[model samples]
Target: MGRPPCCDKVGVKKGPWTPEEDIILVSYIQEHGPGNWRSVPTNTGLLRCSKSCRLRWTNYLRPGIKRGNFTPHEEGMIIHLQALLGNRWAAIASYLPQRTDNDIKNYWNTHLKKRMKKFQTALDSSLVSNSSSSSQLLSKSQNDMNSTSLRSCSTYASSTENISKLLEGWMKASPKATTLKKDQEKEKPSNENTNVVGTASSQFTQTKVEEGECGVISHEELENFFSFENLNSMAWEKSSTDSTPQGSLSSLNDRFGTMTEVKERSSNRPAYCFSDKWILDEESGQVEDLMDLSLDCCSAPIF
Candidate 1:
């Protein structure tokens, strides 16, 4: 007779596990550790079979478990490993520590298997066409040859195997070639740093000449230009000019005309009016809006 099951099938729940059951199982495992599945359902009072409990923990609830779409790098690894290992998903999962054997199997069956099959079909067709053309060329070569039997025994299957091998070799060698090139570039810069230093000095001299041409001002000159004395003199001159009746009228007109000029600047939309009077005046229209709201509130009777 076969060995008895770990847990009886009778009275065992078989659907998706509830959150409460998960929490209970996780708590029990945390306290007592994960092995000895025969006692887990008995201890935690979960209605699941031992197999289901173990699968849930290993596939989903286990710590450090990664659950999401696989990355491209991971997809490549899975395809390459699958080609090498065949249907031994457990062995493949050992290479991908984050992925479970079940997940890897499901993903391969659902996604990668179809893609690889389609690609294999295309590759076979192309190889067949290439082989037929090569056979024609070989036959022509044999006909041209005198008294010599020339045989071309290359098959489509052999050609496909050679191509796969060539791709594998290229994949292995590409990284090493890139690293060697990068090292050569890095060494060149370090060995010829004198040119870099010379270029930097030349750039600094060019900047100095540009500043001279642009009339660069000294710090003292800038300070004198914005001095308090200069400011007071300018203010006195402006005040004296505004003291005249015509100048006062012209200044007032200019102040009032600024809003219209701003409006005219943007013909498609109305420009907002902004002035010192609107900002600095204490009695603006804001008080009226507040008063209107307060009056309405006081006049209305609340039930």
Candidate 2:
């Protein structure tokens, strides 16, 4: 179906409103107020059509009609509201108390739409970059975890193997010593002087072996090994002392020293050396370990 005409054709002028028509329309509306657009032109003696007079008043001469360019904030609000409400310019205009739908619609078409497109593009780019960064961090974390697990397994296996070798050496040496003792006993009567010297030599050899296997690790040396724990305890003590002004510095130092000694005795020592027999030589494993180390170093604080 064809669209209906805006106004009746009989004895009504159309098109652009003149300056005189504007003054007449503005004056008439100001004096009598607005209602029936069809009778406004005739009652007010305006040569212009009723639709034209209404348009002039509503679009331009109406009270609270905001002129000039829209602000950035207003543009943002228009774009956002437009996204929610679509092309319902009249409804959108109602929210912006001082602006007309005609003004709003023009601004949206000429300026607001382009600004919104730019905003959307920037938002999409930021989201993509953030997503990529998050994925990289997650992958790095997983790699570090895997490396830690492998290192633990390797250390455990090496320790077990070293213990086993030590036990086997002890077992072999015990039987040989027992056989030598029995032989020495049989020969003791035939040469009493030789037996005395032989016994002393054997005792010295056994002492040397025991000393070699279990190195002389002093209490002071053990304490130094747990220096990190001592440092941590000292920090804690300092923090507590700061809170309590009455706390004695000497007492705090003594407590820290005592805790350090206790930690040294309790802490499990790392193996002196991982047996070469138990170390893996796989290139893939080495690469993974290097990657994990890089990630750890990056994440760790320098201090």
Cα lDDT of model 2 by residue, 192-242, tens digit: 223322432233223322233112334464344323333223323433332
What C-alpha root-mean-square deviation, in Å, does candidate 2 show against the real structure?
43.9
RMSD of 1: 38.8
Tens-digit lDDT track of model 1 for 1-303:
798875557888887666667777766765565678878888889998888899877766654444445654455455444533345576456445566788778766655555444433443454566443433433432243311112232243243334334433543456643564454344332223223222222232233233231123334643453233432233223233422323322332333333234344433321111111111121234323422332243321000
- The TM-score of candidate 1 is 0.41
Query: What TM-score would you give candidate 2 relative to the actual structure?
Result: 0.39
Q: How well does candidate 2 score on lDDT at residue 99?
A: 67
* Count of backbone clashes, every candidate in sequence: 0, 0
The segments of candidate 1 whose C-alpha lies over 4 angstroms from its true place after superposition are 1-8, 131-303
